[model samples]
Target: MPNSDMPQTRQHCYAYPHPAVTTDVVLFTIRQRTLSVLLIQRGTPPCQGMWALPGGFLEIDEDLETCAKRELYEETGIEGVYLEQLYTFGDPQRDPRERVISVTYFALSQSDNLSPKAASDAALADWFSMNELPQLAFDHAKIIQLARTRLLSKLGYSTIAFQMLPEYFTLSQLQSVYEILLDENLDKRNFRKGILARNIIKETGEYSRLGNHRPAKTYQVVNPSQVEIIK
Candidate 1:
């Protein structure tokens, strides 16, 4: 049904041209000990056949976040993710078709097992490692760089990284997540000490044995849905 919320519009009201609005999503997940972002091959023009973030133009009645989620699902088949608004890119020359302003969002996933089936204007979908991204369409590369910087900044004070971890994970696995995202090696003992001191996670009284190493303790976040600053 057409929404009745908008008031009646007159033909002359469209006198001034307004910029087109769009929404793009940057979804990150860990796979094969590497951090990766989801990308889709554009089936239509502007940047046909080029790999880009999953996104599209917003519908007239839909809200910003709804458009973001819809575009992401239509292009990449990824859904039910918690998205955070990152920024707005309003460069007049950003789009070839028209003066387009894009609102971008980002999300973190705990599993990389998702299978992306391309639909709508997407020809293909795949994951690209952080250290190895393909030539992206539009200003997507710039958007990703900013998202990375923001993720790194949040990792220092918030439990945002927990979204990338399983319910029951070892301290080593936790440190690995931080190291992978930060692109640096962290001291295991110190990392464990500091994280445990935050009181965000609790010992589960279970252990995991990885190869020749002895069993390591397991822990789970005290509140899975709580997004609190540990610092």
Candidate 2:
């Protein structure tokens, strides 16, 4: 039975999902003792002329880390490095269109082998000194600050620093990396004592040649699974 007041059939509520879920990779590298972060110039609107971290929408059946690595490769032509999940960004107003939640990842790579080749969609991709980053799109500034802080704090008692360094490095080079990240000069004697006390570095019985100085011995980060530095 149709009633005069009921002029139409029942209407159902349809849900439109958010734009997409994505993962952004914040690749950090230490070159000549200064920390650097990777960024790319956007090729589209909403921040078309701005610099941004490497990222993109996740595939339908991809894992977060996989998506992060893929985006890194796509935007910067880099691959295969130690990457760790940093944090997630989901401020309602972060994206202009629909909601977007980006899972951020941090990675360490060798500055020598990395070559910045912008993807087809990116105007440019390059590494900038961490101290002199330009205005970034989205909440990238906040993400970079957080990553820098975490890297410094963790360096105090963790083996995470090895990720940013080559497999074999000199004590001076290692200390330099610490100084750049911590933003504080460390006494040579004290720094050596702290590192040696950890029993986490093994002398490789090899030496490295430098300009206008005596060759320095090389050392490697002892496997954490095999050595216990801090109790």
Candidate 3:
């Protein structure tokens, strides 16, 4: 047997096997308790012209979160917000063209008065309610489900719901968002007590003057930096 110190005649270079790692962002916003996800129309083959989440290949030096935010802004003109890592998808055949792996991030944003501008390779970008989604390309549908589950779990104890609301809103409006996301009715008094008890919200001294009944007082999530869990 050759001495262990002897070098082998064969040469081997490190190669990145299969498809490269990529990143996908599931940007969600809530309007009237209806959850909406941002999607872009693809401009190339493999899923050309189909709707998909805003995402792209990661740069060699880019971190996962950095890639996600860059992709979000490049594809949908969205920026500067709370983004949480959700999951990674690495099915060998997930991408027809290559064995691409994707790290998915879920981003929350205020649903009111924010419109997306299509950029990058996206010909069009728009927010679609989870219920009314068109056929999504790739494993994006699955990614959305994963994000939804994480969001719901977080809502039980975290003030994550406010990420989808405006700076000032009525209690009913906030409650509606909770009901929609949780898919259940929350007792008004109980909800109020829980919310007030948390001390994470502040009265805005504003009211919704256009409602059928007397205008409800408006409030906003206080301590924007607080990440209180409801549970």
Candidate 4:
């Protein structure tokens, strides 16, 4: 392997500075009929002690989605949940340290048994109700607003609402999720009829007994992969 007589080529590097790229994740869950978002208290300067979405600077070798999941896990001890790319925030003055761009993602999960432990650059990790959010660091408030808009829009068409529910749930529970996100009450008869008409959910042959009242049949999404726009 000593035939290296090709003028000894050298590696090239960019001469000009460039903006840094990072990733952020917005995790949403419903607890006690209230929609909440996961937030981390920043431990470092620029916005120390301020609550923000879980995220960090992207590693050079990592993909965007990979970076997002990794940051989420690192900061909040949460992983293996469904994540979707929400949008990109590249405002030049978004970050005070330097020119930084953040590619944000949104995730949905049931908060039944999941608890967050702070790590990495996070001093604390917890869920805050959407209706009562703390002062957010960076441009996270805007990012979260956008994510909320996307979540509401997607709920009307996609089966993503199920991601925030358990595998087996009653129709009342399912309807509650829609009602919480839509922020309004839906007609029980029409809601049931519309959901059943789509043929998206099927009975699981299980019934939940609710305190001397009639039992409610449990159901699960027929095809979690199928999404339909319902009006």
Candidate 5:
């Protein structure tokens, strides 16, 4: 029998011009009850000093997801959040340097406490609230809007919002997250009723103490790693 493990010969397929591939990450977090996203000021040419998403040209051997994670960490010193592939943008003129296609990933992170330092083609790293974004470079603003829309659409039918909360939180905190992303105030009773009926969280028997107010009962997501579909 022929050896199944035999190495196949490699050949360079240069017959057709191929565009370079890249992976960009849109890291979102809730800050002071506002929805925010991470941005990097480019330190290199082609958009130097302009704000953009953290990303780089994909190395030939690495998968798209791995490239996204690597680019994010290298530019912003952020990692560990589960990123969902948001979209593929292959417009002929998205990048000024060359013909490049971007596979973008987005994630909700409890990353307010983590400080991001700029490096590796990034001049500075910071979070900007969705309401007040600065001038962005290389079509990054459109990418962010698409990511935000995806998150909003998933909130009603999935447990995706839990990724933005801490391990234990009050129902108010959970409701605030939804309100901030949804951009509308939710009725406390109805929101609580709808959320509790889903059975995605359970009481930790803990209480969050606020200034001069009654302690609010704290709860935890039953399975933080999986986004259970509700409907």
Candidate 6:
């Protein structure tokens, strides 16, 4: 006989062991005309000392995206950037320690604004060029490849590239970001024509005097929330 006001203890309904869940982040940025990714060196075992995407096990109290953001901040000291869930890796053999599943997220940020300091389970955090990445832990290399594919595909239809630029930038500066991500040089005439046709950006009537050349007119996204696919 228990008091009606007292909390009741719930009995276990099943005894099957559940797979441990984790979150990983793939942070990308453009620097010096090159696209790069943020990676951390693991300090703990099961691929200790290897470069891996910043991540950790999910906590019971957190949601998937919340866990991903928390792990990114804990490992690289980076927070408050645009993060989108990339994919899930559930291969039973992906992790050496028991059965684990990973929900990975990809983030975009301006490289000039980020200065990663390794913390938590990370021994070191640094940016690496997409073409010259070190050996990665787990299936992180596969995850990065998938992220790159997603980014390239999205560039044609979304305003995501703006995330790597400042609030106001010149057309040339914007083109460089595209060139870096696409890994190819674009014809200036055609590029400008296409961009103007799409009407995605608005001229700010401001010019950049940072370089020796004549000032270039600055522009910014007309509607940051709108997606006008590039032709």
User: Whose TM-score is higher: candidate 4's or candidate 5's?
Assistant: 5
The residue-level lDDT of candidate 2 at 136 comes to 96
- TM-score of candidate 1 relative to the true fold: 0.91
Instruction: List TM-scores for all candidates, in order.
Output: 0.91, 0.87, 0.87, 0.92, 0.94, 0.94
lDDT of 5 at 146: 99
Clash counts for the predictions, in order: 0, 0, 4, 0, 0, 0
The predicted structure with the larger TM-score, 1 or 4, is 4
Q: Measure candidate 2: CA RMSD.
A: 7.3
Deviation (Å) of 8 in candidate 6: 4.5
Please write out the lDDT profile of model 1 over residues 1-231, one tens digit for every residue: 767997877675676898999999999989888989999999999899999999999999999999999999999888977688999999999999999999999988876447778999999999899899999999999999998888889998899898898889999899999999988998878988899888999999999998899999999999888667877
Worst 10 residues of 2 by lDDT: 222-231
Q: Candidate 5 — worst ten consecutive residues by lDDT sum?
A: 107-116
Alpha-carbon shift of residue 122 in model 1 (angstroms) = 0.5
RMSD of 1: 3.5
Which candidate would rank higher by lDDT, 1 or 2? 1
Please write out the lDDT profile of model 6 over residues 2-42, one tens digit for every residue.
Answer: 79999989887777989999999999999777899999999
Write the residue-wise lDDT of candidate 2 on 18-37 in tens digits.
46788988889986677999
Q: Model 4, range 1-231, lDDT digits (tens) per residue?
A: 757776776797999999999999999999888999999999999899899999999998989999999999999899988889999999999999999999999999899956899999899999999999999999999999999999998987778899888888988888999999999999999999998998888999999986787999999888765444555
What local distance difference test score does each model get? 0.90, 0.84, 0.87, 0.91, 0.91, 0.91
Candidate 3's C-alpha runs over 4 A off are 1-12, 15-19, 205-208
* Candidate 5 lDDT tens digits, 89-109: 999999988899999999778
The residue pairs that clash in candidate 5, if any, are: none
Question: Candidate 6: where is the Cα deviation over 4 Å?
Answer: 4-9, 225-231
